[model samples]
Target: MSDQGSSTSTSQTDGDFEGELDEEVESEEGVKEKGRDSPTPSLSNFSASLRAVIRIKQKYQAMKKRRQEMVLGLGAGALVGAPGRTSPKIFTFDGLTPSAFPTLSSIQQKKKKRRRKRVLFPTGGGRKAMPRQERSRATYCLYLLLAILFLQVYNAIENLDDHVLRYDLEGLDKMLRREVFGQQGAVDGLLSHLKDYLSTYVHNKPLVVSLHGPSGVGKSHLGRLLAGHFRSVVGETLVLQYYVLHHCPQEANALECARNLSSHISEMVERAEEEEKIPLFIFDEAEHMHKEILDELWQLVASKQSNEYLNTIYLFLSNLGHGHITKHMLHNSSSISMAMTASGRHSNLLKELTPILRNTLEKLHPLWTEADILPLSLLEKRHVMECFLDEMTREGFYPDHTNIERLAGEIDYYPGAEGREYSQTGCKQVVAKVNLL
Candidate 1:
């Protein structure tokens, strides 16, 4: 039994050893198979791929930078050339090829064919159908013409110096005081009107701007400023001459006077459109204009009549008192009645009068009276004086306190026709004299 057991154990040991040997062989085979399947890249091939990627990146960057340079250069050149160039075409060498020459030849041949079809002198085969050489020449010629046009336009814009700067809302307080120094009533009324006008303008309403009061109240100055502002927005025109009835010859009848003024106004309107592109009309010293002139002026101001011709933002500087505007319209004259009715306001005087005029002016219920006047009291005049004095000092036009007081006193004592003085003494004339001085 012992011998049998030993023999069996020896047999089992042999089987175990065989199994171990088989397992070792299988593991070795698997390792060899993996080694065969995986191959390593060569240094040369790896380097070549890396170089290719870098080159692509570099190429992209170069192209991006080139595009930027081209755009910037072209824009700069265009801006620099705009002043001297008229034609829209630009001279450039980009995108040219040998094949382009052949295309140009073909274009020339086509143009020749077209010319053969048309016999007119320099009229046939318009610009589009022209030969390549002719087209190039024409383009260059157009450029020259455009250059001339640009030069002319520049000159015209540069020469428009007919504008005068007036006090804007930013400086109104100072301006009012300067004009109405001692006359609080006048200053109050004028400043209020100016404020109203500015407000209306800000609201984009159609304004019939009229400055009406006694003579020497700086109406013309205000009118000119308002006109300049209008011109700045719409355009500008130079009034070379403004001839009144008194300035004309003895033979110039009222009809002739009207015709002459109309002709001047028409020309001015046309020039404003053509040259200055201005749409506003300003009439300074409108009160001094004759009845004939007033009739024509009214026509111009009436939006329905000459608006097409005038394109006017109308401003009338008048010495005609606010009372006349209200009272004169009620007289029942046909012309006055028609003008008042069509004036776009209850009264003809309200047509282009200052917005303050509405509040300051008392309604001339039966006829004109002191009650109907919107008086600028003494306090208002003093305020206005301070405003003007402040502005003048800021503008480097300094005056002594005594001088300012003297000026104010003058406004308190001015004389006028019909025993009608300045709403405050010396206010109007003193301001004018100071400005003149």
Candidate 2:
């Protein structure tokens, strides 16, 4: 009975230990359930939850801000007004809110605001930047002005035809008529032929003419006139004139004159032909030079064998055949008259006198007289009076015809010359007489 009581007590102790363990376990379960249901949790657990939420919110805010910054950077990079941009875009920030994320237009506006406040100098200046369009236009205009200046410099260097300050062809002819008297037909013939000759040197033949007439005539005057009028046709140093009386030293005989002439002619011809220019040689007083000079002269004209001299124009003036010329004019005295436009007896004079003059020249110098015979006729009373009146007009003064005739009476002429009483000295003394008047 003692053993059974001992066993029963042991069983009751085990039951009690089990029952306490179960109550403890049940209490722990109830506390866990209460903590899960209650608003106030453990301090450490509440703090851990709060830290996790704060970390997540910070990550999300950082991501959003980064995305906004990327958009702003993109907008700024895309649009800046610069030259050579084909497609232009304008950005605006009208209704954008400040707190909102930065948009493309708003970011662009911010960039522009910063730029406006920024310095501009060599970067920009004391004033606002000059507009890009205005700057570009100014650059282009400056370039154009430089180009024009360069072109002007080139033209000035070339110096084409403007070297001749005066180009007056017709004015020359009128002046010739005013200065010379009683030879309009001869002067007109010279002008017509010279125009054709000078322009086309290689086309036909050069003009070779000999002035055959009386003394005190205008042969030397005409030669000088030609040289002065066409001054621009050649270089200033190209004119060559030979007066027989002015040949080297008074002792130079015909042979010396011939030698000097041929040598000088050859050199001048070479220069003129090489440069493709027309040179003028006026040989005056063939009658005075020895027969040998005449022969050299004839060879120069007739054969023209010197290729160098082919382009030169030769004018030989002399009183060689005036005796025949005077007889012919006196023979045609009844028909002789002077008109401004009419060739009159002067036109027929060449045909009749050419044969006579050619025969005389041919006999005198062993050469074929291949030349244009220009006979300068005698000055009539009317021509003299007109010349006097024109001279007074040129001197800025005027005089009546009565005074001119009275002054002209101081001159003398042969009486039996078929009423053709041209003065013994022709018009040579008239100038002296006018000075006295």
Candidate 3:
């Protein structure tokens, strides 16, 4: 009985112990469950993922900003090297980083703004900034001025094809066409001055009219016409003399021979006075006249063979462009007075003239007042055709009126401005074509 009790008690104790162990296991599982349900149980893993995502976003933003900065920097650099910018290339230190471009908060810490350094153009000392339109206009103006200057230089070096003394009065008279053919309006201003001089200078007054212009601009042609016109009017009985003064020796003793020459001139003047025809003196290349010779010529004009012939008309022909003459000789106040041709206010040409010459010109103002010819107006198409017809008739190749009318119509319609609108060449070409037909 005692052994049975002992075994039973032992069995009970073992059963209780196993049950406790199972309960402990269940408690351990419950604790594990509670741990899993805890709010912060996976905090480390969650934190790691969040951190990684944040880092990725930051890297992407940084890369994007860097790319934008690089693009901006490259564009700025390319613009700096462009041609004709005139502005100097600027190397900016700020473009290197995003932080360099300040926010409003950091602006107070920023350094004072510095002015951009000016870049000078190599052609001249200073750099001048011009707008696009102004720059283009300036470029065009420069090219045009250069072209004109080149043409002027070329003409100066070439020999003049026509002589001023070749055109006789008869030819000039026919050319007048102002009253006859109605083309005088083209050159009336030029002629009016001559007419005034003729009327005011007392016919025998030794007149000095300077004709100055650029080479190949018809100064010589005009001079020839003037000389011939005077010759025709005064008759061949009067020795209407034209002289091209040549350079003589510079020595003081050679002046005596010059005086002898002057005496011979005086004799000629006296003889001219004896005749009723006015004695006209035309000096070719008056710009090149020796100073002594000029002085002598002036003396001759002043000298008189009694009251019969008071002064001889003097015409000085020059082919130097108007500016050159004004620059060297026409600065004087007398230049304006002595200018018997132009009646208007002093032009750029008058301002450049010598002051002494200006005063001399003012004395001749009366002659300018007597001018008969005015500014040239455009010639009618019909008148131009008539003149062309007259020349063609003289050639003995009479063009049909229908053909002439057609050519005139074509010329009138051609696009051009004054001086080049109706070309003389076009008319001649028409005549030639008609003759061929």
Instruction: Report backbone clashes per prediction.
Output: 22, 4, 36
User: Candidate 2 regions off by >4 Å?
Assistant: 1-171, 203-206, 248-252, 304-306, 337-341, 390-400, 416-420
Would you list the C-alpha lDDT of every candidate in the order shown?
0.48, 0.67, 0.48
**Reference-based TM-score of each model:** 0.36, 0.56, 0.34
- Cα deviation of 401, candidate 3, in Å: 18
Q: Which regions of candidate 1 are displaced past 4 Å?
A: 1-207, 230-253, 274-276, 301-307, 322-384, 387-398, 410-426, 431-437
Look at candidate 3 and tell me the lDDT of residue 375: 17
Tens-digit lDDT track of model 1 for 59-104: 5566556655654465455565355434433456666887766677
Q: Candidate 2 lDDT, tens digit per residue, 1-437? A: 33343345545655655665566556555656776898888987666556655754665566556655554454454444423325323245844687777779989999999999976556444565554753668889999999999999888745433332233446668878878877887888777766556544463344577787876556767778777765666765556778878784364477887888888888877887887667777777756767778778777767746555666677778888878877776677666553425365667777778787888887876643667768777666666666677666666555877887876676665455566666555677666666664
Sort order, lDDT high to low:
2, 3, 1
| Top-down TM-score ranking | 2, 1, 3
Over 4 Å off, model 3? 1-190, 197-205, 237-257, 302-309, 324-437
The residue-by-residue lDDT of candidate 3 on 39-137, one tens digit each, is 656766556556655765665566556655654554455456453334433345753787766788665444333223444445776866564553567
Question: Which candidate leads the pack in TM-score?
Answer: 2
Global fold similarity of model 1 (TM-score): 0.36
